[model samples]
Target: MMNNAKHYNLSLDKRLADELKSIGFIRAEQDLSMWCGKERSYFSSMRCRGYGLHIGSLTLMAARIADRMNTTADVRERARLRMALNIVNAVVQEKCRLREQELLTA
Candidate 1:
């Protein structure tokens, strides 16, 4: 007989981190270092109660970067950036359940 053992899944926080990282959320080494240099409580808050906050911050950062890249580009690039920003906004606002003001300040 084949053994059927139950497998435990990761907690929601870890899952969120994995998903965000998998979705092209790359940052500069300096930015990553600065972010990492924060107090452990910051990561703990993100890991525990700030999943939405982190998602908001990531999406906003992506949008900001896209805007900078699109400044001297063509319409096609702007459209692409718009779409990405919109999707990020929607995900952070709806899927991640972030309040508008909280997301804005994130």
Candidate 2:
């Protein structure tokens, strides 16, 4: 069970990184922090702690990806961005549902 969870986390990280790279966040932590409006090393710290991006950061990323999609002129690139946005949106929704469930149980 622990291994499965770890694998899932790693896959999620890779997927998010790939999407971010696709949309021009290629300068590692610097660009990612800037794009997500976070302090330098924020994301790096989160990853080091085995805690993936918070919901707020994910929300910000989704919004930026949507904005990029709108301004993108190439249909293929727009479609790609749209797909990335969809993935981020789904993750956000899942996180929200989990939070709601936690609150209900509490």
Full-model lDDT for every candidate: 0.43, 0.71
Compose the digit string of candidate 1's lDDT tens values, residues 21-46. Answer: 44444232233213334443554555
TM-score of every candidate relative to the true structure: 0.36, 0.67
Q: Which portions of model 2 show Cα errors greater than 4 Å?
A: 1-15, 18-34
Q: Report the lDDT of model 1 for residue 63.
A: 61
The best candidate by lDDT is: 2
Task: Provide the lowest-lDDT 10-residue window in model 2.
Answer: 1-10
Worst 10 residues of 1 by lDDT: 1-10
Q: What lDDT is obtained when candidate 1 is compared to the true structure?
A: 0.43
Residue 77 shift from truth in candidate 1, angstroms: 0.7
